[model samples]
Target: MKNRNIDFSMVLALTVHDMKNSLGMLLNSLDELRMENENTFDDSSKFNTLQYEAERIHNDLVQLLGIYRLGENNLSAHVEEHFVPDFLSEHLARHTPLLKGLDIECSIVAEDINGFFDADLLTGVLNNTINNAIRYTKTRIRLTANEQDGYLVIGVEDDGEGYPEHMQHSGTLSFKSLDFNTGSTSLGLLFVSAVADLHCEGERTGHIKLHNGGPLGGGVFELWLP
Candidate 1:
């Protein structure tokens, strides 16, 4: 008898891809249902929780797929010039319904400048970051972008209790450093770091910073792309 080896990573990747697609469809349906029955969903905590959890899971699946690609050396950024303010506004619009339902005041403050990066990769990072902010924020969240030093800095700030001291850092993160024993593995941060590293210019590459105290006086997640 011949024994066959199984590629578990490939299997997990395929499963995550399918789950992501299914969750996308579910989110679309939830949006439509909310629009059609705004009165029912708007003030229902249970409904809000349902939507939020689903969205969070969807974002996690996305990060997992990206990580899988990164492991396979298949992930890369296709940089392009994009207007910062307009990009922020459009990205924020995706969560408008959920934000309104939760009574969270979300705002964007970006300079009218063009940034060169991969929109799709950045969108993935922003989606996860904003979802985390929405979960932790007290009642407000802010998104900001501008050119700083020699990089384009995009930030997500929330009015929640800031990150604990140990979690705060300024550098490129590695997935291998994640500790599974902790309840939070910081998978999203690893994926964000990978995406950031993909955007390179001359001698500098992108990186992320975590610090407390932004405009909202809370935890801030910053992505600096060179």
Candidate 2:
């Protein structure tokens, strides 16, 4: 008979999964409360702050789970073709809870193009971007999807201050090379980089890029998928 050994990794993964589920429930509760008092609490900073913090916790747990997956040899992408505009629309819907009013407007532009990506993985990647953008965007956010030089290029742009100079690299910067001096190494960046690394085709792999100035003339996040 084989001995049943306790796997610490599995334990930790389960723990994180539980924490994520609990955080999700909390977010849902907040959503219900906000809906019930939409008019009465319109532009309520307190509710928004609580929701943002809950989302941050949810994202952190997701990234932690992603790190666990990246360390395993079995991690892989579940790719599928999706209509660009529709995909972006659905992604935006997920953040409607957080983007109530505040004079912020969001729109998507895609011209009958389609992109092949792992929906769930990209959702996590976009979750980080949307959360971060909502905090910094002044009045507008734009999402664009198009084909560029044999790759599917998806961009998230905002009309606010752009990325710091240190992060404006051409491609996904290595985690080891990130600015650890300020202890600001973005866990979201690391998670998205790993997800991009898991997707590959014919010597081409997905990658993330940070840049300033797009249609919005502000911070732009581009995810390129081969």
The per-residue C-alpha lDDT of model 2 at residue 138 equals 96
TM-score of each model, in listed order = 0.97, 0.92
Measured on C-alpha atoms, candidate 1 has an lDDT of 0.93
Estimate, for each residue in 1-226, the C-alpha lDDT of model 1 and write its tens digit: 7777888899989999999999999999999999999999999999899999999999999999999999899999998999999999998988999999999999888888899999999989999999999989999999998889989999999999999998898989887788899899999999999999999999899999999998799999999999
Clashes of each: 0, 0
lDDT of 2 by residue, 8-28 (tens): 999999999999999999988
lDDT of 2 at 81: 87
User: What C-alpha lDDT do the candidate models reach, one value each?
Assistant: 0.93, 0.84
Given candidate 1, what's the lDDT at residue 152? 95
The collision pairs in model 1 are none
Query: What's the alpha carbon RMSD for model 1?
Result: 1.0
Q: After superposition, how far is residue 53 of candidate 1 from its true place, in Å?
A: 0.5
